[model samples]
Target chain A: MSLLQQLRLGFRSLMLHKLRSALAVLGILIGVTAVIWLVAMGEGVSYQAQQQIKDLGATSIIIRSIKPSEESSRDVGSRFGISYGLLRDDYERIVTNVPTISRAVPMREISREVRHREYAIDGQAIGCTPDYFGMNRLTIARGRAISEVDMKGYANVVVLAWEAARKLFPIEDPLGRAVQIGTEFYVVVGIAAERTAAAAIGGSLDARQYDRDVYIPLSTFRARIGDRVFTLRAGTTQLETVELTQITAVVEDMKEVDATADIIRSLLQRYHKSVDYAVVVPKELLEQAETMRAMFNVLLLLIAGISLLVGGIGIMNIMLATVTERTREIGIRRALGATKGEIVRQFLCETVVLAGTGGLLGVAFGFLCGPTVNGVRMAVGAFLPEVWSALPPNIRNLEPRLAPWSIIAAFAISVGVGILFGIYPARRAASMDPIEALRHE
Target chain B: MNELQPTVDREIVASIVGVSKVYKLGGHTVRALDNVSIDFRQGDFVAIMGSSGSGKSTLLNLLGCLDRPDSGQYILAGRDVAAMDDETLSRIRGRYLGFIFQSYNLIQQLSVVENIEVPLSYQRPPLPGGRERCLKLAELVGLSGRLGHRPTELSGGQQQRVAIARALVNNPHVILADEPTGNLDTATSHEIMDLLDALNRAGRTIVMVTHENDIAERARRIVRLRDGRIDTISEVRPALPVVSGSIALERL
Candidate 1:
């Protein structure tokens, strides 16, 4: 039989049993859709992570001094709370000597209970220069944060975070409010805007609570508060004193972060013997995010492959049944001098048609899946308004990143699956005893 | 159309030597053809006649190269069909031997003209003017006006006639017909039998398998099979002519 005639006849058979053919193709449709939709979602999540890391300043190197845990002999539950990590001279050396580094901002934070008449809130007292706000994206909502003038004179002004303002004075303006920190009192000079919570970039850093923070000049903290400040907890008997908690260094560009970090690591090698300091490069975090993205896609593909496997089995089953139903036809075609290869090709063509039809429909369905997911999320979000505050990443639906190559790959793989499973049934039909088949009632 | 070319010597159309066919069904061995040998010459109208289980069909299949015997050589035309590959055997069948199945085996999806054009599809370099060839074959089979009709639309005899045209489309050396008239009524059977006879008169070799005595009588020679063996070979007698009476003049 000619190939065209065989395909035409196969099409007729499929058309004759429209519902069965449709059901058979639905399996493949769902399989292909799953592959596209799941892979697209994985890509979307990975892309979002990379963007967030970029926003965190990809060139920035973070050096957090983890207070040594070996000081358990002196303290109870917490580590040593004092001047630890690399010396102050090392930060000066990094800024002056390393031409690779653009700027270095050293910071120290202390948690102290602050009171205002009846309302008292416990929050972190952040000690850093004015340049720290631009580096960490802390925008002032009411008044300006401490500038170079305040850092030079060592002033006693403070900035209240958004959460502190709402907690201390819910109905009054917090611009000129006075809050007492331990035995000292400082007037509120500014209110910071809300910032995104830092959820640890790959377990290298701790989860950050950006809401409860009060910014003060580092020079003022050193002169007035001194290095050994204490906080007596309500339940605990000991005091918590900390000089500096973190130091963020900004390198010139992406290429310099590695060399500057290497230089700083060697410099800090002699300062601290313990493994207390954690230096983080957002560049490395970005690379790790990309690797995680690839792994996620592979995992999704494997899950999608199961559906494809089921689709392949369905094709095999239908082809086998078709061979049985067309026994006499096979015999007649054989008698008419069709080669066994021709018979195999005829059956394979029929299977390929089923798979191709399914693949096309699946691509269409997968394209619409993005909108469908967003619609469902929006409907649920409407019922619960409190969840709106949790809607930065959730506000936008997962962008379906349709890689052109993925579509081609998916369709090609589906056809390959079809042919691979189709071969057995085709061979069975071709190998039938012509005489026996002809005599079949 | 010019009749089979008369060569210097007539070729042996088929030669079977010590051919045997055995079958195993439900673990019980059945000998379909046993220790049988036969020679068929070109231009010979041969009929294989036997009752059921006599292995007539088996012998027919072996001769057509559709089945290989267990322990014998089958040479059809000039090739050893028993040793030929399936692909080669199919090609040889398409080129050298035409087939007519008991069910007519006309592809129901095809028109009468397309049915006749099937065998011609496998012809080397293709037959020239396919439409013309198809129309001529259709006219020869008395289906010229019904060329556009599908097989289901044709009568049983007409369908068989179309099957006959399809078999000869490639101009094969022999036609192996497996009970071509089995599905037809008495009148239609005779019509098909007459068509086979006319092809035989045109010098095309034919081999038919049938148990009907009247049907077998139309062939020039008959080979009777019994118990998977050839029982006898007999010549068919021509019909006796009726005597003519003296003419009476009725003119005034």
Candidate 2:
């Protein structure tokens, strides 16, 4: 028989038991939809992580001074206090010694209260050079940033972050206005633009917020605030002095990041007595993110494959029952001169119809993943405010990104599952004896 | 015995020579057909009659190429079909034989016209003008108005008429009917028999298996079997009369 006629025959036969056939299709539909939706969500999450890493500038390396453990600090403690961290001399050494280092910026930050006309807010006071603003991707909203002249002259000038600028001078523009920090009044040279927070990358890099910072020239910070600071701990006064908090170095070539970081680490290891500094490369984090995305996709596919396996089993079950139920029909066709191959083709056609239909419909639903997630997110936010608030920021702001390959793979796998599970039942139908099948009532 | 002789004047369409079929039923050997031989000529209408297990059904099955004989040769249209493979046997059946069942074995999902077209669909290289042939046959069987109606919607007589039309669609060398009227009322049975009689008169070769002597009397010859052997072969009716401008069976 022609293939079209066989398919029509199969379709008519399946229509005989409508509910049974629809349930079989539903099994495959759920499997395909699960694969697509899960992959899209996974892609979205990984895409977000990769974007954050990319934002950190691939050629830049960050070195942060970590507080050493108590035992290490006690070993290095002097009569004044424990003093262990990146110093100004280390920054000069890295800049002068590393040939690949194109530029470097040194920064020191401390939490302090800045006040203007009885308005006070706790903010991070950052001492940095002109290169720091460009390296950190910070933009100026008003006036000019701290200049080379300010650093050379040790001028007492500061740049208020967007939120700090808004709070310290609620109604008036804060440009050229003086704000007090630790008994020193510094003029606000500029206001930094608002920036969204960057997510933390493993344990190596901390999440950064720019809105609560007040930037000042490093020369002026050292000349005015000095390096020594005292704090009361357990009713006893302790003194600590630190020259630098962070050093960000930029390389001319991306290929030199890893080698340059290694050289810097060993150089610091030779000078520092304890492990008190961390070197982070955005390129390494980007590679790690790529690996994470691959693993996540594989894991998602595995889970979705299990569901499709169950769906395939359901198809086999339905086809088996269909074969048993239509023994007499097989006999009739055989008597009418249908060969064994024809019988097999007929049954196989029915299964392909079932799975192909489910696959197309599942792909159609896959395209709706982004909208569906958004709808559910909005519904939760509107109906269950408390629950929505409890969700992590990742889930709350998730944007599902459909991967084209996943859609293609899901549809192809579903059709493949149909054929894989269909062979046995079709063979069973073909092998039935015509004489016996004719006798089957 | 003379009546059993093959007539040299007419063309023989099918013949079985020294054919025997054995079956194993619950480990006991049952000889369904034992050393049976018969010749069927063109335009022949033969009825086979016997009691239960008398081998009439077995003889019909063997003649229809649905079963292989244990020994001897069965030839149809000059081909030795007894030892043919399953696929070739099926092709032979499609090319040279048609079947009508007692229960009107019409596929439930198909309409009357599609039911008639089923055998044609199985024809290798497929017959051209199949749908037109199906429509013409349906009209010949007086079912043109019910062409699109399923078997379940038709009366028993109407369903049997559709079966008869299906049997003619392939233009087979032989038409095999297994108790074609067993499930019909007397009036419906006569209606079906009339349709079969008209088709036979139009030069179609028909082989019918029935228990009713009255049904057998309608055929030109009757073969009776007892205990897996032929007991009698009788001429019941004269030769078919030449009819003018009747329904021409098209070679689809």
> What lDDT tens digits, residue by residue, belong to model 1 across residues A25-115?
8988889988888887777767666766766688898877665564742433345544455446656766777777778898877778777
What tens-digit string does per-residue lDDT give for candidate 2 at A190-239?
99999766656425344576788999999998888777778778999988
Candidate 1 — what's its lDDT?
Answer: 0.78
Q: Which whole-number lDDT from 0 to 100 does residue B86 have in model 1?
A: 94
TM-scores of all models? 0.75, 0.92
Model 1 off-target regions past 4 Å?
A1-6, A57-59, A65-90, A93-102, A107-246, A250-277, A383-397, B1-44, B70-73, B107-155, B201-203, B237-252
Checking candidate 1 for backbone clashes, the offending pairs are none
For all the predictions, what are the DockQ values? 0.34, 0.74
lDDT of each: 0.78, 0.88
Instruction: Give candidate 2 misplaced runs (Cα > 4 Å).
Output: A1-5, A113-122, A160-174, A178-186, A199-206, A224-241, B1-9, B239-248
